[model samples]
Target chain A: MKTVLSIGVVLGAFYLLWMAAVPVMNIKWEVSQAQRAGVEVWLPESGIRAAGNWQLLSENLHLAAGTYAQEKPRLPSPVQVFAELWETTVEKKITSKRSLIFHAQVTLSATLLGFAMGTALGVVLAVGIVHLRVLDASVMPWAIASQTIPILAIAPMIIVVMNSVGITGLVPKAIISAYLSFFPVVVGMVKGLRSPDAMQMDLLRTYSASAGQVFWKLRLPAALPFLFPSLKVGIAAALVGAIVGELPTGAVAGLGARLLAGSYYGQTIQIWSALFGAAIVAACLVGLIGFAQTVVLRRMGMAR
Target chain B: MRANLNASKSASWAKDLNMIQPVIEANRLNLTFQTNDGPVHALKDVDLEIEKGDFVSFIGPSGCGKTTFLRVMADLEKPTSGTITVNGVSPEEARKSRAYGYVFQAAGLYPWRTIGGNIRLPLEIMGLSKSEQAERVARVLDLVELSGFEKKFPWQLSGGMQQRASIARALAFDADILLMDEPFGALDEIVRDRLNEQLLDLWARTGKTIGFVTHSIPEAVYLSTKIVVMSPRPGRITDIIESPLPKDRPLDIRDTPEFIAVAHRVREGLRAGHGDEV
Candidate 1:
């Protein structure tokens, strides 16, 4: 209920701002026309004049409606974006090219694939760094340095290179997502794997447990709390990577494609709806991961 | 030469009595930790022998290397110089054979695991059958008086109960020796006293050689058959006092003349070690 109230307030604020912008632009255009015609216009009691009468209230209302309902608006109103979302998702078939769900499905497939690849890679790298001194000394620094290279700059290079190697479409995009997602996992898992204190480690040593046994029984289980939070971050990064991956490719079948298409045609409503759609998808993914974390940790008796 | 002769004699004596061998023996043991601040002599020329079924306690102040000595016996630390054996084998070998169970100062139970799961951890690692693991877990939990807490997580239990669960974990595999480093040091006086009595009962029933480290004079006196008093600054043994108290000690026995006398001796030993440092 609180969330709903806050969202309502934010939407109302945006609507008021939108209503205000329309008249400001309209008056500026009208004043410029009057100056060009060499007519000395009197300042009306209210802001705007239309057809020589100070129809301020009616004209403002008309301008507001026009701004909100425009087929191609400079800044689409909330109702316009919401209507676009409703049309794309509810009016169209799921498999239709015009469907927001179709675009979302395309993006989600790559995000999930990338997330899985990233998680596996991160966990493997973490284990290597933890167990092997050479990897700790060599690979960890490189893993950290890899993240400093901005994904946006690297995504095109990766996509182009993979295209040259005859790997295009989903694989290139998924690879970008994987690249973005893995770093948090590596950092989180490494810290988690080493979370057991000196006494706990010594207790395991006293048992003469093998390294494998120790990993499975102590280190891995201990890393769970750390791992789940990282997975949430990783999945979000994966979605961002996937969307960004689509931007450079000019791909015509994802949310990123919809954004590009909307921008090219000046369809502000379509772009805004696509942005909201991506946010909702990312939120659902993270929420799903969080729910899984609670269940798993509870079963392990780590959660209250 | 004298140590060699004593070892041979004990071996023969052990055979004659059909008893378990000496649980731990250390001779001229020295452990120097090389830190950024230079070498800290954690232990120096420490000599000790612990036989099967003996309840031995190492009593000393902080930095006196009592815990270090216990760690050495558990193969958690390597001595810089000299030799230490656990159950007639090198510490590492003995550790590999699962000859001893070790309890740390804290309960050290994995918070993620249920009480039963924590107790069964070693059994699972040792690849015991599921039924056997459950049986041992149940038996050890019963021994530690935590029978119904099998499904409860470590955080749900009180501090003293958590410590008992840890002890139960150690006992699950039935190792012949138990090495504990200040396991009850964190508890309140009443809880510590109760645990001390329960521990003695556990010792009597199990017949395991126990090595305990503690800073408390009364605890050292009450729980141990032999108290090894130690001093810091090179970390050497000052005195070894064998308690004259009976094995079957109630909590009220802490007030007895014999217990008081032993406690007094331990206090003096600590004071004398301080005097030497000064």
Candidate 2:
């Protein structure tokens, strides 16, 4: 209850500040316009626009109200953004490409697919690195190095190469998501797989347990606590990758395409709504992983 | 030595005669660990023999090779140079045959598993029938007086009870030899004393060849039939005292004059090992 109240208070304060800033910035723009026309302007109140004369107070109020309702303000007020969100999401039909929900669904499918592939690749790589000294020496460095290249710089190339090979649609986007997500899982799993202390290892050795038995019975269970947190981070990164992926595909039908189309025509409210939509999707994905983590760790008695 | 070697190699007919052979024999055992600092001798020229059904305790200060020697018997560590035999075979061979169960200093129970599940781990790994595993788990839990608490997780139990569950886990596999490394070292003295009494009672009932490691003089003298005292800085056995106590002893036996005398001798041996450094 307290957390919800705190979040509400924060959002309320942010909206109030945004509402006040929009009107004040409009008056400041008016003052700048008057000064450019060689008409002296000054304000009695102390603020950034103190040089503006107070004679245009009624005109400034009308201009401020206009700024709040503008079709393309430099920064849309919170009410405008939310209204746009409601129209695009709740007001549109589910099947309509104009609906943010429809775009969100497209991005979500790619996110889930990429997250699954990334998790599998990460775990497999971690297991290989743990068991084989050769992989640890050779593959681990390359895995680390793979993350240093900018994904934006490489995303277009990946799409182009895949286009050349006629592998269009979702696969190339997922590969980028997997590329971003796998590194964290690999690093986390390696540490987790090695978390068992020397004494525990010695206990298993006394049983003369086979390597496969040791892995299944000990390392795998031990690594689970490490795997879930990495998965949460990976899912969020996958969402970001899916969105960025939509950009290079020439503004098709996802949230990334919405962002691209909004920016092309200076649709500020559209851009803000799309941004909030993407954020909501990322939050939902991360929250779902958190729910899974709690349930699993509780079942394992690893958490209270 | 030759007779013992032959007894190990000979067929089952030789075993029908009930041959006298050491269950664990170590001759000139040495282990040196190479660290960043230098080579530190963990065990040096350590020769020992443990007969069947004997309760042998290794006692010393920290860095003494008591735990090292037990680990060697478990094949958790290999001696730099030595000839040791467990159950008339190489340590590795005995280990592969699952010839012994080891209890660590900590309870080390898997928190995810209930007490019953933890005890079933070894039996499961050994590929026992489900009924057999259940039976053995029940039996050992009974042995440790933890029969009714099988469904409890390790964290739900007290420290002493958790350690007892670990002991039950070891006994579930029915190995003839048990190696314990200060299994009660973490508990308070009152709990430790009760556990010691319980352990002696269990040992008498089972008659398993047991090797125990400890740092306490009274603990070593109270529980062991043979106490090997060791010292640090090259870690060698300074003295081996054969206890004159009877086979069965109560908790009050520690108050006896003979128990005090044995403890005093152990303290002396430890002091001698330190060689005026203390």
Candidate 3:
């Protein structure tokens, strides 16, 4: 109930802001239309006739309706965006090219595949960093520096290079997601692998346990708590990476394509709906990771 | 002062019978840690011998290197000079052979594992059969009086119980020697006393050579057959006291005249070491 109320409050504030902007947008649109049409208007000042004032008010009302329902609005109204979302999602068949579900499926696949690859790379790098001094000194700084490069700046280059190498479609997008997701896993895993105190390490040493045995039995389990949270972050990063990967490719099958198409056609409502669709997909993915974290940690007896 | 109980007979038996061997031997063992502040002498010229089935306790204040000495025997720390042997072999070889079980200051039970699972950790590493692992886990859990609590996670148990579970883990492999570093230091007096009594009984039953490190005088006196008193700052042995108290001592035996006498000697030795500091 509280969440609902909070959401309602946010929506209420957005509606009020939209209502305020409507008149301003209307007047601006009218001025631009007049300028484009080269229309000159003369206004009578200090009018005492009630009929004239009523006529002005009616014209303003007509202008507000036209602003709110513009075919190519600069800022789409909430109701218009919602209607577009419903029409794209529920009105179309799941397999239809026009369906948001079909587009979401394309993005989700890339996100999941990239997330898996990224998680694997991160955990391996983390283990290496923790166990091997050379990697710890050399690779960790590079892994950190990789994240500083914005994904948008590199995504197109990556797509183009991969295309030259005969790699196209899903693989390039997944590569981008993996690139974004792997860093957190490496950072989290390294910390988790080293979480054991000196005494605990000594205890294992006393047992003469092999390094492999130590990793599997002690370090690995200790790293689980740290790994799950990183995975959540990685999955979210993977989603952003996947969408960004879609943007520069001129791809026509994913949510990114839908956004590009909306922008090209000045379909503000379509763009807003596509943005909302991506957000919802990311939330679901993160929620799934959180659920898995609870289950896995509980099985390990780390959680109640 | 050494009591030298039947030393002539034991010496003769060791020579003639060739059945008795020292479980641990340290000869002029020195370990200096190189730090940013310069070399810190953690252990200095430490010479000691622990015979088979001997319950020897190293008593000293903080930074006395008692724990370091135990770690050296466990091969967890390397000596800078001289040599130490466990089970008549180098510490490293002995460690590889799994000749001794070590209980650290903390319980060191993995929070992710249940008590039973924790105990089975060593057995699993040793590549024991699953059945054997389960059997040994049961036996050690029984020895530690934590039999019914096998399924409980370490966090679910009390502090004393967690320590007991750790002891069970150490005992799961049935090693001939046990090295404990202040395993009961964090417990209350009552729990410490109870654990002391239980440990003594466990020692008697297994006849394992035990090296215990502690700061408490009574704890050293009560649990050990031989007590080595140590001083800090270039940690070295100041005195070795052989307890006259019988092996079959009860908790109330702490109040007996012989127990009190031994405790008094331990206190005097500690004071002597402190006097040397001044």
Ranking by DockQ: 1, 2, 3
For model 1 chain B, the run of ten residues with the poorest summed lDDT: B14-23
Better of 2 and 3 by TM-score: 2
Q: What RMSD, rounded to one decimal, does every model reach? A: 5.5, 4.6, 6.3
List residue ranges in candidate 2 displaced over 4 A: A24-62, B1-19, B276-278
- The CA lDDT of each predicted structure is 0.88, 0.88, 0.88
Query: What TM-score does candidate 3 get on C-alpha atoms?
Result: 0.90
DockQ of 1: 0.77
Candidate No. with top TM-score: 2
List TM-score per model, in order: 0.90, 0.92, 0.90
lDDT of 2 at B68: 90
| Ranked by TM-score, top first | 2, 1, 3
Deviation from native of the Cα of residue B179 in model 3, angstroms? 0.6
CAPRI docking class of candidate 2: medium
Output candidate 3 Cα RMSD: 6.3
